[model samples]
Target: MFAIFLFVPARADAAFCKTGETVTLEGEIIIPPVIDGGEWFWPGKFAKRPCQVTTLRGKGTLPKECAVGKRMSLTGRVLDAGIVTLEVASIRCY
Candidate 1:
């Protein structure tokens, strides 16, 4: 009886993404323009851009290449429906 239940699929199963897959997302990476450590940046050349990936927590997505204000295409491994983990992630700025 317990074995039967174990194999049964839930009537309503909601999951973000079921598999770990890699996909290339093209967008400008941007940093929020707000005070983090009691400081705000002026919107100018120095300020970050929309398509820039400044800092990456994990591997691949290189900060040196994906700097502020660059329209880039990045490949990421999907961790969830709206979340993705970078694995050997690379970017191309356009």
Candidate 2:
């Protein structure tokens, strides 16, 4: 007798973040999920999992559209995924 099996493809995981680096982020900007959960990023893919934004790097300026202490979805490319720094591209209020 012969048997058939199915295999699933694995997706690439985001690189680990560290201090002095940038990272893309999304999901809720909650308070204290981790110290500075809304401030300091947890660092991961927002699409597949939860992510955090620790420092904005003062790249340009704070977003006026999205208010602090509110759930939001953000999309930006990571300059450095290590230690989680992000350059905010777009945001959607929830």
Candidate 3:
């Protein structure tokens, strides 16, 4: 008799961002098609997951170069980790 076992690595369903925690993230800016809608961030090169940006406030203002489809780095406080909501403190376009 012979016994065989398979090994599998654990997978993360969603990126970890604790609520009320300050964090810096790098990603591309995304604008919704609808009017009056806020912006979103698509983190990582391959895993373009959408993270909602509820507000933009704090250190500096959003630059003109930080437009949709442009890659940028931002620091903010996580409002909701489930949907990845952030209240941006600063923004820098790369």
Candidate 4:
């Protein structure tokens, strides 16, 4: 007899990019369950994670039409899976 198995894993933190560094990522903006659970971010595909930059300085200027999984280019510092990208130099929808 043969058996099939399925595997699922818990969310993992993203690669940490130190402050003052630049990172360019393509993902969607999402609300987080971290840091009081009202955060924002540019999420990743596997974990649906963000880099933890939702409440940063340049956030207000970003056009939020990319919130619904449209690929957007976020260039800035890398934070974490629950949030990402800060000091955003540019945001463009693709």
In model 2, what lDDT does residue 90 have? 59
Candidate 1 C-alpha lDDT tens digits along 1-94: 3554356655432223223655454545465333346332222222122222222223322445554577656554545333323322555655
Q: In the order shown, what is each candidate's alpha-carbon RMSD?
A: 13.2, 6.7, 6.0, 7.6
Q: Evaluate residue 8 in candidate 3 and report its C-alpha lDDT on the 0 to 100 scale.
A: 75
lDDT of 3 by residue, 1-94 (tens): 9999998768534455567877776665675222233444333332223333444333333477877788777777877544545566676786
For model 1, which pairs clash?
28-50, 28-51, 29-51, 29-52
TM-score (C-alpha, index-matched) for candidate 4: 0.43
What is the C-alpha lDDT profile of model 4 across 1-94, one tens digit per residue?
9999887667565654555566665554454212223334332442222333443323444464644556566666544445543655666765
lDDT of 2 by residue, 1-94 (tens): 9999888668555444444433444555443222332343332334323344444332333345445466556556545555455555655555
Instruction: Estimate the TM-score of every prediction.
Output: 0.38, 0.37, 0.51, 0.43
Backbone atom clashes (below 3 Å) for every candidate: 4, 13, 0, 6
**Per-residue lDDT of 1 in model 2:** 100
What C-alpha lDDT, on a 0 to 100 scale, does residue 45 get in candidate 4? 40
* Clash count (model 1, backbone only): 4
lDDT of 3: 0.55
Q: How close is candidate 3 to the true structure, as a TM-score?
A: 0.51
Q: Is candidate 3 or candidate 4 better by lDDT?
A: 3
